[model samples]
Each structure stands twice: as C-alpha cells, then as structure tokens.
Target chain A: MTLLTSAVAAIVCTIIWYKNAPKNDMKIGILCWMYWGATIMWFVDAIFEYAELKAEYFSPAPADMLNDFFLGLSVVVFGLIIWLVILLIKDPKGVIKSALSKKAN
Target chain B: MACFLISTAEAVVTTVAAKQIEKNENLREVNVSEVKYSHKTPFSKKLKWLRNMLWGGSALLLFEHVWHGEIVPFFPFLTAASNPADAAEMLHEMATVGVTMALLVTGVWGVIVGITTAMEKKAEKEDAAQIAEHAEN
Candidate 1:
C-alpha cells in the first residue's frame, strides 16, 4: 500500500515535471526524484515483507491497510513540505524574493 | 526490520560531505578569479539531490516502522534487537533489502547526474557555436 501510494505520487509529480520542463520554475523535478526514490525503496521493502509473509502478504488486516494508507498520505505531505522549503530557499521563480522586497518597501 | 537505517546512515554521511564540499568550493571561489558559466550547477548541489532523496525515503520508512511497532523509542531502539531470532531476521533484511535500496537509489542518482551533465555540455556547445557565428559576421 505504501509502495502504491509512492508510485502514484511519483507518476503525478513526473507529469507535472514534464509539463513544466521548459519553464522549470516549480522545481517539480525534485519532488519527482524524491517520490520515485521512495517508491523504489518501498518496492524493495514490500518484496522482503512478502518473502516473509508469503501468501499472507496479500491479505493484510483492514486496520493495517488503513494505517498504511494514512502513512502513505503523510509521506506525500512531508515530501511536499520539503519541496516547499526548497522552493522558498531557491526562489527559482523569484516569488519569495519579490514578496520580501515588496514587504521591505 | 531496520532496513531503512542503511540509507539513513548513508544520507547522514553524504549530507555532511556535501556541506564540507560546499564550504571548500566557496573558499576556492574566493581565492581564484575564474570565468563563471551560467549553466554549471555545483557538485555539492548535485550531491544534495541524493541526500534529499535518501533522507526523505528514510524518514518515511522510519515513521512507518515506528507506527508498526517495529521500532521503539527506548534503549535497544529496534524491537527486533531485543530478540535473538528477530535480530537475525532484521540483519538479513538489512543485508538484502536495505543494501539493495541504497545501491538502487545511488545508481539512479548517477543516471540523473549524467543526464544533467550532458545537457549542460550541450548548452555550452550551443553557446560556443553562437559566439563563433557572431565573430564570423
């Protein structure tokens, strides 16, 4: 479930990154990298867990699935937060820079 | 059980290395007078890409382990560490899954750096061609 979530996030972010490839202002590529990296990690984790659980890996408890879903969502949120911080620091679009200058005036 | 720790440890080491490299690069820049090219991103910045990916993935995985009670806040830290059987299993997972994940991420990062470096090279070539054309005119 975590792998699925990260894969979805990676796909969505990759699309965004592709669309904005020319402008490159959003730095969406970083988000894509982060999500895809996580997806790969979770994929390996799932494989190991499945090796241990065997047939039972398919039948996760409902509560466990729910918890995993929440975990996945929170991971996405955290990735976005990190991206936001990078954007603010880099200010690729100069949005923060302009805002700060405006405030100074 | 604690497979993600491998990547987390690598991230910590790389993060410190990146900082040190950046500091050294800054000092080098101050001591040298060199023509600056616009498209060349620093190596330290590129290293940050790996750091960010590893750190982000490790953090999420750590949180997941904690949520699942595989990790504890107490002494041993890892619940598996307190048990002999589970400790062996945990070490096996670390050797296989953990090491694989870290290697895969680093490999992917290598590809990314290669692509970006190629792109920068192409851009530099184009700039040189334009300059030569202007000189000819």
Candidate 2:
C-alpha cells in the first residue's frame, strides 16, 4: 500500500512537471527520467523490505522500522519540496517561471 | 534546517559570483575574465556538490520507506526500538527519494540554463543585425 502511494505520488508529480514544461526546455525530459527511475528503484526496495519484514513477523522490529522509514522519508520529501520552492522564488528566471510564463502566454 | 541554511548560503554566493560575471559580460561587451574567487574554489565546489548529493540521497532513502509500508508511524509519535529490516527499508526509501529530488532539481536547473542561453543568443543576434544595418547605411 505504501509503495503504491509513493509510486502514485511520484508519477503524478512527474506528469505535472512534464505537462507544464516549456516547449524549448529539455530539462523536463530529464526530470521525467529521474522520477521514473526513482519510482522503479523504490518498488524493488519495497519488495525486499516486505520479504524481510515477513520473515521477522514475530518481532516488533517490523513496526519500528516502518515508523522510522516513514518519518525519515517524509522529512526528505518535505525538504526537497522546500528547496524547489526556494529555487523558484530566488530565480524567477528559472524553469518554473518560464513554464508558467509560457503557459500564461 | 541547518543543512538547508548552509546550502542556501553556498548557492547564494555561487549565484552572485556567476551572475556578476554574466552581467559584466553583457554590459561591457568585453572578453570574459577568469578570477579565482572563494566561491569558485575547489573546496567550495566540493562542498556544494556534497550538499547536493546528501539531499538527493536523503530523498531516495525516504522513498524506500514509503515503498515498504513504513511511511506511516508505527507508534504514532513514539520512539521505538530499532529493527534492522525496517531500518533497511527506510534507508532505501530515503535514498530513492533523495535521488529523485536531485534529478528534479537538475532538470529544473537545466531548464533555467537553457532559457538564459536562449536569451543571450537572441540579444547577441540582435546586436549583430543592428551593427550590420549600420554598416550598410
């Protein structure tokens, strides 16, 4: 379930970035590749994690691991989002502005 | 927060130095100058790169956690004992997310660079055309 959510989020974000990319900008394509690559890796990792968790079903380790993982991931994602926002804000000449301006036009 | 602050400071310094050079080139119509500034020093460059890597790595680690159903807290704000399997999963998610975020940032940066390049080219072409017209006249 967690994997599905993360995959969905990643795909959605990628699509959003792609659809909004400027006509002349090639970076959006790169972003698409990166997002998809990360998503694939996440899926693989999740499978392995699940298998290991199952093996340790009798222990509380699984639950503890799950909590820590979520907390850490959340922080990272939030941080990334913040960084993106800051970059856009600091550099109006950035891709986000270009994309938005082009859209406006 | 500390990491963000440090990275932001580094970014600001780098951007300022680069932007200054860009501005000088645009305004003076002079050849580019190469000066060894602190911001452009090897140590500074390495620090900037390391910051980027750490951020990207963290994102990937987060994703691994999300994938393994560890995204939600098990104890609901309570700290629990460590579990290697869970920890491994979490680490993977973090690293995955970190990488993904880094890629996204790079893509955005590329777009910005492209835009700037286009603008510069357009300006240069315009100047050349004007000069040609003046010569013909």
Candidate 3:
C-alpha cells in the first residue's frame, strides 16, 4: 500500500516536473527526485517482504493498509515541506528577496 | 527489520562528503573572461541534488520503521538487535534491500548529472555562436 501511494505521487510529480521543465521557477525537480527515490525504496522493500510473506503479502489487514496509507501520506507531506524549505532558501524566483527589499524601502 | 539503515548510513557519509566538496568549491574562483563556457550552477550545487534525494528518502524510511516499532529509543535502537536470529535477518535485509535502494538512487542521480552536463554544453555552444554573431554585427 505504501509503495503504491509513493509510486502514484512520483508519477504525478514527474508530470508536473516535465510540464514545468521550461520555466522551472519552483524547483519541482526536488520533489520529483524525493518521491521517485522513495518509490524505489518502497518497491525494494515490498519485494523483500513479499519474499517473506509470499501469499500473505497480497492480503493485508484493512487496518494495516489504512496505517500504511497514512504513513505514505505523511511521507508525501514531509517531502513537500522539505521542498518548501529549499524553495524559500533558494528563492529561485526572488520572491523572498523582493519582499525583503520592499520592507527595507 | 532495519533495512533502511544501509541507506541512512550512506546518506550520512555522502552528506559529509558533500559538505567538504561544497567548501572546496566555495574557495575556487571562476575566470569569466578566460572561459568561453561556464556552468550556471557549480558542481557543489549539483551535488546537493543527490544529497537531498538521499536524505529525504532515508528520513521517510526511518519514520516508517519507527511507526512499525522496528526501531526504538534504546541502547541498541533496533528491535531486531535484541534477538540474535532477527538481528541476522535484519543484517541480510540491509545488505540486499537497503544497498540496492541506495545504489539505485545514486545511479539515477548520476544519470541526471550526465544529462545536465550535456545540456550545459549545448547551451554553451549556443551562447558562443550568439556572441560570434554579435561580433560580426
């Protein structure tokens, strides 16, 4: 479940990154990389767990799925927060720079 | 049980290496007049891309492991560490799954760097041609 969630996020983020590749004002590449890395990590994890559980890996408890889904969601949120920090620090668009200069004026 | 530790360890090492490279890069100066082409972003800045990818993925995995009680705030920290059998299995998983994930991410970053370098080269050639045309005008 976690793997599915991160993989979906990675796909959507890739599309966004591709569309914004020309402008690249927001640095969406960071988010794309983060989610893609996570998706791969979870994919490997799922493979190993499947090896151990075999048939049981397919049928997970509803509560466990819910928990895993929430974990995946949290991971996505955390990635967003990290990207936001990088954006603010880098200020690729100079939004923060302009705001600070305006305040000084 | 503690598969993510391998990636986490790699991240830690790379973070230190990145910092060192960044410091060295900061000390170096680019001679704009002597160079026909230059990278818009420095190598150190490019390394940050790999650093961010590794750190972000490792942090999320750490959180997930903690959520599942695979890790705890204790002397050994890993639940598998308490049992010799589980500890061995954990080590095996770390070797197989963890190392594979780390290598995959690093490999992807390498490809990204290659693409970026090629694009920069193309841009440099275009810039030189434009400058030559300006000179002719």
TM-score of every model versus the real structure: 0.80, 0.32, 0.77
Ranking by lDDT: 1, 3, 2
Q: Count the backbone clashes (under 3 Å) in each candidate.
A: 0, 19, 0
Q: Per-prediction interface RMSD? A: 1.6, 8.0, 1.3
Q: Compared with the true structure, what per-residue lDDT tens digits does model 2 show for residues B1-137?
A: 01122223434565466556556546644453654222122233333333443333334544444444444556431121156565565456445543444444445545645665677677777877887999999
- 1 versus 3: better TM-score goes to: 1
Q: Which number leads on TM-score?
A: 1
Score candidate 3 by DockQ: 0.58
Expressed as tens digits, the lDDT of each residue in B40-87 for candidate 3 is 667777777877778778877887888889989987999999989999
Query: How does candidate 2 score on lDDT?
Result: 0.47
CA lDDT, candidate 3, residue A18: 94
Off by over 4 Å in 3: A14-29, A50-64, A81-105, B30-37, B133-137
Which should have the higher lDDT, number 1 or number 3?
Answer: 1
Report how far off residue A48 is in candidate 3 (Å). Answer: 3.0
Q: State how far residue B45 of model 1 sits from its true place (Å).
A: 0.9
**Colliding residue pairs in candidate 3:** none
